[model samples]
Target chain A: MTGAAARTRALALALAVLTLLPFASHSQFFVNLAMLTAISAALGQAWNIAGGFGGLTSFGHAAFFGLGAYADAILQTRYGLNPWLGLPAAAAFGGGAGWLIGTATFRAGLRGSYFALVTLAFAQAFGVLANSLDITGGGSGILVALHPGAGRFQFTDRRAGYALAVALLALATLAAWRLSVGRFGAHLLAVRENEDAARALGVPAVRVKSAALALSGALTALGGVLYVQSYLYIDPGIAFSAERSVEMLLVAMIGGAGTVLGPLLGALVVHAIADTTRSLITTPGVAPMLYGVVLLLIIGLLPGGVVRIAAVRGDG
Target chain B: MAEAAPLLEVRGLARRFGGLRAVRGLDLDVQAGTIVALIGPNGAGKTTSFAMIAGFVRPDAGSVRFAGRDITGWVPERIAHAGIVRTFQITQPFAGLSVAENIRIGAFLRTRAPAAAMEQARALGSELGLAALLDRPAAALTVAGRKRLELARALAAGPRLLLLDEVMAGLTPTEVNDTVALVRGVRDRGVTILLTEHVMQAVMALADRIHVLAEGALIATGPPRQIAADPRVVEAYLGAGAAARLADG
Candidate 1:
């Protein structure tokens, strides 16, 4: 099949799978698995906007993730605001933070490994600040009241959360697809490849990168909001963890950093492995160890990620 | 009939790199619908001047105006948007992208719609004799293929003024001839070109006016024939041998 046809088929398959997800045999287990997969896919898609398309390998994306979770938690628990209202708010916060980080560093001509370090530092600092803050519930975290209703976003059934997560993931995927085909997408690719050349060709490097990073952050924050909503609690350690950030990157990187479907495939593969390993070995720490080893093997084999491998195959 | 105004005007443009004056008060003009060649000895700051014009380098002194607008110290993207696009000495094709996709990125500027961009890219590829190679990966292209890719990419941008830096540097004679033809075709489409080249034959054939630089200064500016005859230009570019040949002609 042609590449476009293959992409279309893959997309159709993903949609079909997501549609049938709520009806699967293992209702509770599959719901949890699908929710995790959706969240991971959404986060990975978000990261791909900057890290994949813009070639800004961010190691600090969890800052936005944590921000979204905390923003939702703080608003719901302390102020009695609905989690729904916090969705857009979290997106805005994430986008704003991304803009600030992207501009300050990109304007100073930091990229590649250096840019990654700055992102890492930002996440670390945010984590530290979150831990030190009294109003933010410190490291102990904030609790969200679980009222099984549409208004509260707390559902008695896991299917509802799974469905919502799927919706968010779908939206993220659609946005990624749209951006990857538009003028902004072209500029992002140009900046990713050669900033000087892109600039010479009229691609505003700073603005494009900043916008991409902001979009990435916003999408990531949206996922975070969903995560906290589903869980009904948030803590600095869970929300602002570097390991969480690495997980996000792994999903995007292992699939293909730049392509729209990379993160989704990565999430599917990762979640499959995690599920299989958890089911087979009922042992502690083995699952995480296996996950790490699998990630390393994938990275070693496909340095550019599975999406790139697919692209190569498609080209051939 | 030539009242469209110069596309670029540089006055006393200068730049220094940590106590070294790389470009010193250079003045130049590139008129609309003309091909101007900048020829200079190595380290005479030819590429630096191109970089400044393309806004890669900030001028320490003087003004740069694009199409009668003061664009001094403007950002590179803004300058490019203002219709001044540049090519590198070495092509920087996105290795991961197909040749068609690379050109499609350039064509994105002409129209925001993806369909329109693809159409523009297809048209450009056909014009550049790259229709057959469009689907190929840019990194897989040969050297001459890269030069073509570079031109196709720059042309795809729909630039009003194209800055070509050593595009013909490493081409075979046949490829050089083809490139010269390609450039003329591009010029015929009404895009002004400012090319920096070491190839005297291509410069003589394509450039409407020649500007010879020596030590970051414009030593001579005139038609190719007049430029070839200028003592300073001949001395700077060629030695007494070329000067004698020009004098005899």
Candidate 2:
């Protein structure tokens, strides 16, 4: 077997082992942590599509995530719709929001820091709107009643939720892999590297970027749907928080932004640190402070992220 | 007398930046299956004219017709899809990708399958004498290597009309000879080429027709021998007492 194939096999084995881990552990806290890690990994992967590959670093992914969470929460609470149906609806909402953002910004030729700031403003606006709206249960947030059935998108045991989260992560990772190996991914990377050159070579720069943003938004919305289903409650603060946006970008960057498994590895390290700090400290900001220090060290020492370090060691 | 319609036609193409007119009412034509050279001194708007023809720059007036269809003001990708592709004056390969991958992105314009694109990239690499460097990152290439990669990438797009901007600006004498042959080979393959060049030897050796631009407008257009003897061309580009120097060089 070639080195890449062997590496892929090893990764598959590791993921398989992780998916079966909840069965061996009786601790609900461990399962919950594992689920959170998987969800964050998926979210990071979604962001990587546009931010890493297409070179559109968005600081407002929370808009899509919040839209997804609200789509599910509102439909479930008011319309009594199944969460399975809500998934596609949430994805559509996210994609539509992405279309709007991409069209408005790209048409106006807003790029780089301007594009990032505009996206941030959009997320902030969505948060404020969600907070003021009565349909979103005002600032206090909306609660998802515990139906406790697979049909209701709720599981009686933590194992099912863990399984679902792992599955979603697997799906997201597969999608990222497919994109990285295909024509669309090449176009996106070309646009990222040099938009004018790409367009001169017949790759439609605006269309490629807009498509990437739409796909990313839809996938991120799926992550949001998973989050609300697992937690059974969500407020505008939790759903559309700037911290959530930062966390997603940080996880992807820490892992290696454009790589297939970078986000997953990043999520493991980040969530593990958060879980360990929570267990050891009563302080409110200690975990985030540590995260900042680690990020600084990573950026200073290994700008390519932890994946590059692993690749170098593997070569040795 | 009415002549055959040129593959690319530009008329009254103008552009301005504030008070400075970059390219003013430039009219140029390139017939099918020929290597045409656009020659000028520095700041003669050769690059700007190339950009306008390739749809990179919007013209203030006039139209560009490709295969007799108006393509003025079209987006670069749309114009490229209509079979007009361009290379940058400064090479712009995707530095992070391998040389083969950089070419493969261009090949993707013709094929959707990754395998097919890779095959096309390899063929182009071999054709351009860059097969050995295919797996190396583009950033690792020399200046001449980057220039070759740019040409290879443009070729990989399967262009009917190629607008080359300063492709042979920096190269050794031997490399220039090799590029002269390569340009001939490309023209032999039925791809019409419109190139801006400063290398007199390559232009004299390769160009079937030469067009001279002076101050954003065409000053002379003819066969190489006529262009070389044209006093107007000499005064505009070759300078005083430099015509014999150009001939000697």
Candidate 3:
């Protein structure tokens, strides 16, 4: 079989194994780490669609993540909507946010570092809005009710969070797989490589990038839904925090930017390092500082990410 | 009716960058199935004229008609979608992608299926003498290989009109001869061609007719023999002595 087909089968097998994780007798801390890893993978995959494949590098994915969290929490608390409905609702809010930001930046011909900075600024702005907004409960944040059942998307068994996280990772991984094999994905990559050449080839550069960001935003937002459901609470500081954006980027960058499983591998590595550092050092800000050093090291030593070492054939 | 309008028509097309008139009042027509050449000295605005026709640069004050459709001010993607595509003077292949993937991107202009696009890309690559190198990254290719890859990519789009910009800028004589034949084969496929080249031999060998420009204005337009004999065209290149030297050597 071709590399892509082999990779697909491997992905299916990995997901199958992850699906059974909840049934194992793992400690709660291990389960939490597993859940966090999967969440990071999903978020990384979502970002990779735009930044890795489409070359719409963003530093503000926390905007969509926070939007989804608030959307799900507010819908359940104020509007009496099911947590299940929040999936689509949160995705819409994320997609709309993408559309709003993409239209403004792309139309003005922003690209490269400028585009990255704009995303960072947008994330910070959203964080401020969430901090002050009353509907989001201001600085205090909001909480989901303690309703435990599959119907409510909440579970009494805490291990269920890992299972749900795996499901999200599968969805995002499938998205990356589809992107690698699709014509639109080819066009998006071409645009990423050279916009003028892509335009000359009949690829609508701006529209393709905008669409990529919207799809990525929607997918990233799904992780937000899972977050509130798992923790039963979310504050702007946690939801729209700049660190959340950094972790998403860190995961994708460390794994492999454009490959199908890059983010998954990256998430596992990043989370493992994070948890190890947290345990080793009780001092505040030390773990994040290490992350910064690691990011710089990765950028300097292995620009292609950790997955490149494992790739037997070209990722494309 | 009157010979169905030319595949491309440019009338009074002009562009200026500050005080420098990059291209001005440029008028040209390319008939269907014909390979037309636009030759000029350095700074004669040949590349700028191609950009205007291909919609990379909007003309300062003029119109562009392609197959009878006035396409003035249209974006590059829109113009390409309308069946007109241009190759870059400085080859802009996706450097990290394989030659097949680069051509496949052009093939995607017509089809949405990855299999179909790859099939087309494969066929086009072989036809352009790039079959052996299809699996190699574009960056690894030599100048001649990149030039051929550019041609194959543009052809894969199934363009009705192709604007070839300096496809043979730097090449040995044998490579130039091969490219000339390839371009002729392309015209046989019924795609109209408009090319800008400094390579006089290729221009003389391939162009059905030649248009000579000097300082953003057409100095002469005729068959290759007639264009060679024009004193103004010779003057534009330099003195008669240098012109003869360039034409022969």
Candidate 4:
């Protein structure tokens, strides 16, 4: 097997083992951490498809993430629908939001830093809207009662939640792998490298780009749905925050943008750093500031990101 | 008497950017299995004409026909779907992708299954002398290699007609010879070709007929030897000695 195939097989085995670990060990805190890592990694992977492959870096994916969370929250809380069914509806809303943003901005010709700014503005706008809306629980948020059995998708034990998140993470990774090797991935990368050349070669620049944005948005939404369910809570500040969106982007960028396992590695590093920082720092805000400094250093030293660094060292 | 339809045709093609006519009232016909070269001075709208024909630039007034089907103002994808493919002046390769993968993308337009596309890409890659670079990142290739990769990719698309924009640009003389041979090889596969190049020797050596463009219009059209003798083409377009070189070739 090639390196990529070998890595994939290893990942599959790891996930298979992980599914049984929760049942074996049944540790709540470990379960929580595992679930959190998986969810974050999935979202980061989603962002990588467009930002990394399509080279349309977006700081606004939180809009889709928050919308997905809120859509599920509203449907289940207000309309009394099941969370399992509501997930797809939430993802669709996320896709629509992606389409709307991509169409308006790309047609008017937004690119590079300017494009990033536009996405940031949209994310900010979505956050503001979420905060002001009453039905969405506004800033105060919605709390759901935990039902800890098999089908409720909620668990007091936390291990089942970890297993669910692991499954989701595996799915997201598989998707990223397929795309990186597939025709759409090649076309998107071509667009990223040179728009004019790609267009001249009969690659549908607009439709392919829009489709990438939508796919990224929907995948991120899946992570967001799992996030809301695991915590059994939803709030505009938590879900739609600019910081959260940046966190997702930062993870993907830090790991490696175009590589399949970059997001997962990034999530692992971020979680490890967070844990270490919490132990060292007494102040609440100091940890995030330290993370920011470290990110800046990483960008300065390895702009292609850590995955590239590892690839160069032949570690990956 | 029955006459064969042109493999590709452009009629009344005009593109105006506000006040300037980049391409105005341009018409072209490409016969099946023939190599037609469009030669011009810089800023003479040679690339612009190719862009309009390939559907990258929507003409203000014009229709493009490929394989006898109207493809006027269609998007690049739709035009490509109609069996007309174009290569760029500056070779654009998917930088992070491998050579085989890059060609696979072009082949995907013709096939539904990924496996079939890969098979076509592999065969095309070997034909284009890119079998050795099949697993290497496209960015790692030299300029001449990149140009060849682009050509190979376009050919992998199974184009009935190909519009090659300066594929010979910046190539070494030896590379140019190799590229000319490749172009002849592609033509042998029954793909009609329309190309733009400043390289007189290569074009004269390869093109069955040559069209000279000066300031957005066709100034002259004839065999390579005849175009060399045209005074208007010599002074207005191909400089003094360029005509002599064409004559020698």
Candidate 5:
């Protein structure tokens, strides 16, 4: 294998081995934290597919997250449907929303900051709709009853949830890695660099961007479903908040935007900082304040992300 | 000479940007396996005409046909897939990607497999004297290198009709000579070329037929020697000193 490929495999194997720690730990608190980290990494990876690789920087991915959470939570609470069936339903809903949003905005030739604002607008609109909708439980949100079984997609133990989160992260990383090395990935980057040039070379730019958005939306929705299941509840404020969208972008950017494993690394570092600051500061927003500083520092010092530094060093 | 049907046909291709008529009533044809030159003064609508033909610019009124098929108003990607590809006047390599990767993007137009694309990129790099620099990032290349990389990328798409816009614009004389030979070599390999050039020497050396445009209108079309002797062509380029300049030459 090539050196870079070998290094990637080794790193993946090491991370897989580390996922076993939550299972071995007796403390549920630590296991839960680990699960949260894994979920964040998965979400960040989803954002990376669209924002990083496809070069469509969205500032409103919470729309998909909220949609997935609401789709699953509402179905289980209102109609008494199985969570298993709701998962696919939520994914489809998210993908459909992605297709709709992508097609409309891209077809209209909205790019750069305009595209970002449109996405943000969509998320805010969805959040407002969720707040007033009766079926969604309105501003109070929906609560899913505990089925407490593997068949019901609910786990009795935190370790099992951690395992599922880790599995999701692994699958997301694998997908990103496969895409990074393939023709589709090349097309995505080409379109990102110069859309007109890529089009001249026979890449269907709009179609590629739409596909990326759909895949990213579905994966992010899956993360939302996991989040809802873990918490047993979801509100529009929690699921569709602008802060949630920024958090995903921060995680991806902090680790490495376009690299496959950057999101995981970013999630780990961001969570660690948040955890460390929470212990020292009692202020409600102290952790996020510190995160902003760290993001600024990272952008100023290592704009390519921490992963690129390692790549450069490895190459040297 | 008996002639096969033209590989590309443009009829009444025109475009206007607000009050500026960039191109008006431009008609062009490219015969199979021939190198056609579109020459004009700056702002004579040469680039706009090329853009309209390549499907990048939406012509205000025009029809573009390729290989006997009507392809007017098609998108750039669809036009490329129909065997036409174009390079920009300013080289636009993916700055973050390695040279091989930049070319590989074009190679992917013909192949679905990444390995095959990479192989094609490598082969094209070697053919274009860029084999040693394939691993280098495109951002680091010199202007001449970027221009060659741009050509290599367009060639990687396996185009039957290649539209080159100012491919020799900023090159030194030696580089222009080399590029002139390279462009002729491309035409010799069965690809029809439509090019716009400012270099009269290169145009004379390479073009099978020349078309002159002034103020977005075609003024003359003929063999290089015939064009050099034509009064309208000379007057269009040299203003009123055509006969004197012709005598001086």
Candidate 6:
């Protein structure tokens, strides 16, 4: 108990300090960079819940992400609601969408690549809808007014936006941590390992998987809300980009899926590589190509992701 | 004398897979706290019957009644929730997780706390002679160890009715003997067990009653001694007088 308490306290302290570090960086460039990394970490951790732990490989997480961004944007710009309200709205809508997708696919017994394709289709379909919807401002997109108030969830200090991002990542990290040590997590991992075996032992496989997706979707949606609040503008292409979906999975996979700190570590490395490549190469295609090459090397060399490296080091 | 109703009762349970009549018109009953077995040659529909009872396979015809309530075609998890737990013929352990974690998931059925589940899992592991392997990965275990782990995992669920599929399918005679005693111990703990096995020695030693099947239907049902002597059974499964040979062995 004492060890557990100490570890938890240390973790909380670490997260708290991380949220405050952006303030110390006077350079706007560094602050924005930190914000992006934190955003990626949160999104990655969100995907990890379902993808890593539950063995639910979703290829279209952009669906929930875009839905959340659009939910906030529309609610704030069109419905004339407080941006803070968008936080809960995003979670609700994201969770609901996640539940819907999980129920539909799992009930139909879709798994592996089929489930992945279905989620991808959902995101692609949502992109089409967002592009054409009247309330979404269609292809033109919507802009959130620059309201600098805590109630509006946008702080006048640019670093405060970074703080919000850090806080979101912390919440996601905390959720993953909770799952690793909890009963629900045990059932989930059992289902992932062997669904029929788990069912024989009385695990409600479908329910557990569905609930995990909902939780993951809710958190992922919250990440979308953070993005909109930080930038104050969103269009269909930016909100529903397939590349963003790839980034979320890459962060978790490269950092080590099913691990608590995988996404955080993945976010750091992924963004560092992105930033370095963008600065070093002006050719747009070259930057993406370089990113792909580096990722391929990491994945090929460390198949279990960077977190497994920590495991090896700890044991050896 | 009016006998109490059976803990489990199957009436005319049937299923057909495409061109094959896998199970047809099968009936079964087991009283509380008894060690019964469903025995037959391969494709005798013993496994299929067990699957229907445990809710893994839906029956094409007839009903499954437990404690006087109909539970036909319920999902496997829901049937397990009703105190009926089944273990696979092919051992299924979460390979990456530790032996304790494998049992802990079963314990999770009754408790929501990890500490409690882990504690119970450890206790069950030790009871099943797996204390030393608690922290080891499940995939590291031998066939005998996996069989024990399967039992420990099911026992952790505190099941009233345990359906074991070929639990002793592949094991040394010594290991089979150990499992026979282990199963008898489980029955003494107030669990009703229904097993499907080709292990005749185990069947003779453990089963209070035995049901014999052939070609998707029951051809004989009696006590272990009588089952060994049934002419229909001997013709269908056992040789002309294997009972005397079995008794000698």
Q: Among these predicted structures, which one has the highest DockQ?
A: 5
Compared with the true structure, what per-residue lDDT tens digits does model 6 show for residues B91-178?
9999878999999989988887899999999999998999999988999999999999999999999899999999998999999999
Clashes of each: 1, 0, 0, 0, 0, 0
Q: Which stretches of candidate 5 lie over 4 Å from their true place?
A: A1-10, A283-287, B240-249
**What class would a CAPRI assessor give candidate 5's docking?**
high
Query: Highest TM-score: which candidate?
Result: 5
Mind giving the per-residue lDDT tens digits that candidate 4 earns over B1-249? 016888878888888887777877888888899999999899788988988888878888988888778988788888887888899897888887788887887888777577888899989998889889888889899999899888988888888898899999999999999999999999998898999999999999988888888878788888899997787798766476776677689
Select the stronger candidate by lDDT from 1 and 2.
2
Model 3 residue A313 lDDT score:
48
- Per-residue lDDT for B49-132 in model 1, tens only? 988988888888988899889988889888878888888998888887778888887787667788888888888887788888
Q: Write the per-residue lDDT of candidate 4 for residues A1-316, one digit (tens) a residue.
A: 2665655556546545654665666677777777787778888888988888888889888988888888888888888888886679878988888877887888787888898999899888878888888888878887766776656666677776777777777776787888876778777887887776666556778888888888888888877788778888988888878878888888899888877878877787787787778789989899879977887887788887776654554323
TM-score of each: 0.94, 0.95, 0.94, 0.91, 0.97, 0.94
> Among all windows of ten consecutive residues in candidate 4 chain B, which has the lowest summed lDDT?
B1-10
- How big is the positional error of residue B148 in model 5, measured in Å on the Cα after superposition? 0.9
Cα lDDT of model 6 by residue, A185-282, tens digit = 88889998999999999999899999999999999999999889988888889888889888899999999898787787788789889889999999
Superposing every Cα of model 6 onto the true structure, what RMSD results?
3.0
What is the number of residue pairs that collide in model 1? 1
**Comparing 2 and 4 on DockQ, the stronger one:** 2
Candidate 4 clashes between residue pairs 3 or more apart in a chain or in different chains: none
Relative to the unseen true structure, what is the C-alpha lDDT of residue B72 in candidate 5, on a scale of 0 to 100? Answer: 90
Query: For residue B42, what is the lDDT in candidate 6?
Result: 91
* Tens-digit per-residue lDDT, A57-97, candidate 5: 99999999999999999888888888978779888988889
- Runs off by more than 4 Å, candidate 2: A1-5, A281-287, A313-316, B238-249
- lDDT string, candidate 2, B78-97, tens digits: 99889998999999989888
**Model 3 TM-score (2 dp):** 0.94
Query: Cα lDDT of model 1 overall?
Result: 0.85
| Angstrom error at residue A96, model 6 | 0.6
Q: Model 5, chain B: what is the TM-score?
A: 0.96
The TM-score each candidate achieves on chain A is 0.94, 0.94, 0.91, 0.90, 0.95, 0.93
Tens-digit lDDT string for candidate 3 (B1-249): 228778889899999989999888988988888999999999999999999888888889889999879999999999999999999999999987889999999999998889999999999999889999998889999999999988998999989999999999998999999999999998998888999999998999999889988889988899999998887888788955766676678
RMSD of 4: 3.3
